[model samples]
Target: MRNQLPSSLHNGMMNYLSDLEWKQVLDSLQQGLCCCGANKYADWLHTPWIHVDFLRENSHTVLRYMRVDGRALPPVLPSSCCNPFSPTPCLHDPLQQQRSLSVWRDTPQTAIDTVFDKGCLDLILQPMVELLTAIPIVNGCCIALQLISGILLRYIYTSARNSVLVGDPGGKAYGWIFGRGDCRFALGSSLLDIDKKRAAKQKPSGNSGQESKEIGPRRHE
Candidate 1:
């Protein structure tokens, strides 16, 4: 499926990340967020799967930290982990501790920090923006293709109608050309309308662009 994409699309996907920018993104992921709340950790862990899938579908390499029981481990021990609310501390068997220690020692701190700090949230945003931006472009392409198909169908029907008018004594020379053409036009027009509505929905409001521009220069200072 990836190989079938046009080179321009491939380049567009590539433009979303460079080696350096990607490293920064990865670095950001490695930084651990202070474990303040379970809800925060949950949001950090689960919300980015949607973004990761989006990037993977778009041919971007997605980096993820290892998981245990489907949950991502934090870089440093969170307060919750360090001092549990429960009266008794969760006990790991000696074998479990040995294995955990070995794994912890082997893992790179940077990678752990990236995963623990950011989870997949930052990584997810870049692909999400690209995905949002592509919607209008895709809608336009669909509209264009449908319009072309309708035009061709109309032309073919017109030619057949003309031939029937010239040669056939019976008015029925073109059996159902007009009906078929009308159906094609109706289908095409309906689809175009739907796409136009979608494109409108996908478009960013003027205020958003203005806000971005307004914020851009201040960031450098």
Candidate 2:
């Protein structure tokens, strides 16, 4: 993705004036990212937008383009690349833009003072790298959370069973505690097992009660 930005941006810049949507997208990207051309602001010189034929159609005619230090000046940069805080008047005046371009060629190190010199590729890749770095951390946190939850549920289920076995006051309360709507929803079949255990305990007592009633009726006879 980082290596492909130059060619993609070159194509986008070349087609910028031809398509209004592309023009807007390129403009917004440059302005929002605070970046210039593909690899550097100088890269814009190679795009079709800088050619005389294209410029002539847009009323930016140049009878004879200027040169500085025996080097032809790159045409004015897109307004998007111009630094709003810079004292340079390169963006609004064609001559000043050419002058700044010449200055840049003479001293590449000072380019950012006049226009955004950093490549869009580096700025775009920084955030992507940060997000990828965090993915493992986020995944580890989720796995730890699941482990803690499983341990907690196992502890609660065991404690509830022990309370019922020791005949805690209101032993049926153990059933009610796990049988509530939210608990059943979360524990599902675990609560069903508790219900089955309670039912089994009650059955023997019911049978004993029936046997005693029969014996009493026989003695009366």
Candidate 3:
């Protein structure tokens, strides 16, 4: 459960992992990837992946590759881009796509990216080069861009849901990494404004016995 995360994680991370969440994270990570050969390993588990590293252009990006080896694969990038580290991450991207892992496994699996897919970038080289030249105009912009990009990806694919915790064990106040969460980022500015207004209104010299009237919901008849 989400509320139980702190104590449960504190108790131990693997300890409280539920069947659904476990299956989801594992499914998401190894979704498009399958193993073959003597020793089996999860597919694309390694990051700074070849397509990300070797692709010359967007079109040539490994995500666009038709096959990993001789076998076809799925377009399994996160739907929105946000730090997956962010719990309750928000933001959305329309580009995110989902793929059935079962389909890819029926065919053989492929792991050789640098060796086989090297020439793919040539197709988009010119425009990509032109775009790279313009990068100097933006400095350290990639960090913010990736953060937003990752957040935008959140909407594209189905992710494992955090457990719905009613309360923390023994009723202690639960710890949360809420500072980086979407709810904070989205409403923090407005909340700060409300805090300031409340502080000002509590002053001894402030207006008294004033009540605000409630407005009916827009949809209410």
Off by over 4 Å in 2: 3-6, 55-75, 91-112, 164-221
What TM-score quantifies how close candidate 1 is to the native fold? 0.27
Clashing pairs in 1: 29-114, 30-113, 30-114, 31-114, 31-117, 32-117, 33-117
Better of 1 and 3 by TM-score: 1
- Write candidate 1's Cα lDDT for 34-136 as tens digits: 2322223333223222222233332211223334444322223322222233343322111233344444447533223322232233343457678889999
Please tell me which predicted candidate would have the highest lDDT against the true structure.
Answer: 2
Q: Quote each prediction's TM-score.
A: 0.27, 0.58, 0.14
Candidate 1 total steric clashes: 7
Candidate 2 residues 15-96, lDDT tens each? 7767788789878888899888877776776554644444443334343452332223344577788777787543422444
Best by TM-score: 2
- CA lDDT of each candidate? 0.40, 0.65, 0.32
Candidate 3: tens digits of C-alpha lDDT, residues 1-221? 33453233223212212344633443342222221110122222221122333233344333455354522233332221123333432222112312323323452232121011212123224466667787865645877897777765553221211111322233322222332234546634342354356557666553332322234335556
Off by over 4 Å in 3: 1-22, 25-64, 68-70, 78-81, 84-221
Model 3's TM-score against the true structure: 0.14
